[model samples]
Target: MRGFSLLDSSGLPVAKTCFDPANIPEALHLDVWRQASRCGAQVDSLQRDWRFRGRTSNWYTDGVVFSHTLCDATHYQRTPRHIRRGDSDCLVLKLQLAGHQQGIFGDFDHFSSPPGTLVLQDWAIPYNITTTPYEVMAVSIPRYLLRGSHLMYRRNPVITWQPDSPQARLLVPILTQTLKSLATASAGEADAYAAGITGLLDGLLLGDRELLQSKYRERDRLEDMRQYLSRHLSDPDLGADHLCRQFHCSRATVYRLFQREGGIATFILRQRLQRCMQEISRMGVVQKGFLEALAHTWGFSSRANLARHFKAYYGITPQQAVEAARSHQNEGQREMNAPYWRDAHRVSRWLESIAPGASPTEPAGAHGGTRQGPRELAGH
Candidate 1:
């Protein structure tokens, strides 16, 4: 983990890091890479064929991550446990410059990514991917940053944009040029670059009518399931089995369809907790007995159970939620609303040795920030 910082002409803090020789010997790459990568993916170096090597460089700023890498045959997996922990707080867009990769994605077809194609990976869903030697430019944007983009990536059929598409033709060159320019981009310029790049991604991905229709078509089914969940949250038997029986859907279909929210179980727990909190907030000066009863009504086995999840999700317990509600303290909760990015503090911690007194769960973008120019990179 090597890092250095500088202040551009505008006095903005610029910091960049590169794990150039991520692992001392190529053979030790897999064993030592996690120390450098806080993203929580399991990367296994392949045996035989060729020696394994890679480098990763990241420019940290603007609630976004810009990465450039060069790596050979590697297998990557993010399990359901990783998604439950919310380790991946950003949706990654990989702009393939060379080589290709194949993977399984809940939201898209199991297809190989071709040179010059842009592939988006929603960290909320699990993945199993392998790539050949390749040079690529990738970006990680926090979920909050794209709230207004109207990107239902989980339902979008246009998972990978080919080099021949009009959108790819216009966007690929722009990103390629942007990455090349980042070696010296000023803090102010980096801000503009992030904005411009995300804007184009939002518009281009949404521009195709056929793709947009596919997204809405699936969204209809998901929406119907959501409504069903909302209506039956208090039912003790409400879960994947109930969903399957009611919707005539399979267990695999239930889990696959809800991967957008992490998974079926995760979605159910989060929703129940949220509704429980709403009820608690209004129960001013409640007694222990009432809170205990309220917890069960909201699906928790006990008040203690509710408190555990409440603390994890809201950064406060049920009692505190009541006090804050009475005092009208809504600001902090709003800041914590971006659930996906909530646990991404690992990125910031890896980049700059953790901001002073930053909470372990605080997002990198939530704290005081720094900007950086891209540095030499290989891969991880």
Candidate 2:
């Protein structure tokens, strides 16, 4: 479906469109990226067999937040270089409606949630998400709304609520229903609905309030350190000693707070590399001298140093990234006005081959050693 929209009886705009990659003209199969970007998200890469069907609805309360339900795709989603450069901050609360997902949250901490599980992901941090034909409802909440709510604490990037739990049982249905109502909710009604959802989240997450309350002081100090780091990411001199002196804390305390992000020095380097990556992507395939200057601007010792570290972290050289970006840009421009179902025939064949009992050749490592079956779509 395309160009589909919905509005309330009062004429309030609701959903902008309802689309399914499978039936859409041009068959671009970029629905995953399209829907994600609509909700202020970016994808590092999508599954080769990537196909998506989803709807997005908008709501306004204290601020505008959107709800999205995506189904039938597996991909890695993250804060892209451009989005991160703009300092985008939000929290995505995901309710797994079906299938399974496994990924890393924050710098460490791996998570695998099955169907019916609820998880909270911080948009400020990059994540590597891998899912198999899953349907998930993602509610985008502004970071400021969640600040100081125990949800913002650095140590809790990914919080999971089991579906069978009492809190999940009570809150999940309510949250899902609220999202559904957003499609045609009046402004006043939307505000009340938003408030209700917020209250439920606060109650669910803070139910074990004492545990977070006990570490309030520690969380405060960590936030302070994190703010300081953010302000001075380009400062090569920023290190453990600098933090200790600035925050008036012991070296041990500084280490403990950042231990999950690797030590203080490692964290700083990672931040610098991240900044460099953003710059490189923005610059595209540019002159070597310009690229080197860009690296120096981000506080790297030299372009060589940037190249080595960037490859290690991103698994791609700076030049390669530039080339890829340029190539993607050129291809996008060429297809700018092409039909949406340009490759419909190819997609149709692939889909057919993966139907029940079909022995389609599976892409190596696509399932990470899991057995292939009809349910598992083959990646090109």
Local distance difference test, each candidate: 0.58, 0.54
Count of clashes in candidate 2: 8
Query: Residues 1-380, candidate 1, lDDT per residue (tens digit)?
Result: 01222233554533455545532334333333433354546554332222324555666555567778776555566666665555445567789888777665542224468787888766656666656667789877554444322343345422677888777788778888877777777666776777777767756654654665654656678878877887887776679998898899899998888876678777777777656644653454667587688777877878898889867754457676565344422222222223222223334443332122222233233544443333322111
Clashing pairs in 1: 14-371, 15-371, 54-379, 55-378, 55-379, 56-379
Give the lowest summed-lDDT range of ten residues in model 1: 351-360
Candidate 2: where are CA atoms >4 Å away?
Answer: 1-11, 31-40, 44-46, 54-62, 77-88, 147-151, 211-380
Error of 2 at 226 (Å): 18
Cα RMSD, each candidate: 15.9, 15.0
State the lDDT of candidate 2 residue by residue for 170-252, as single tens digits: 87888789878866665456656655665566565556556545544566777678767767876656788888889898999
Clashes of each: 6, 8
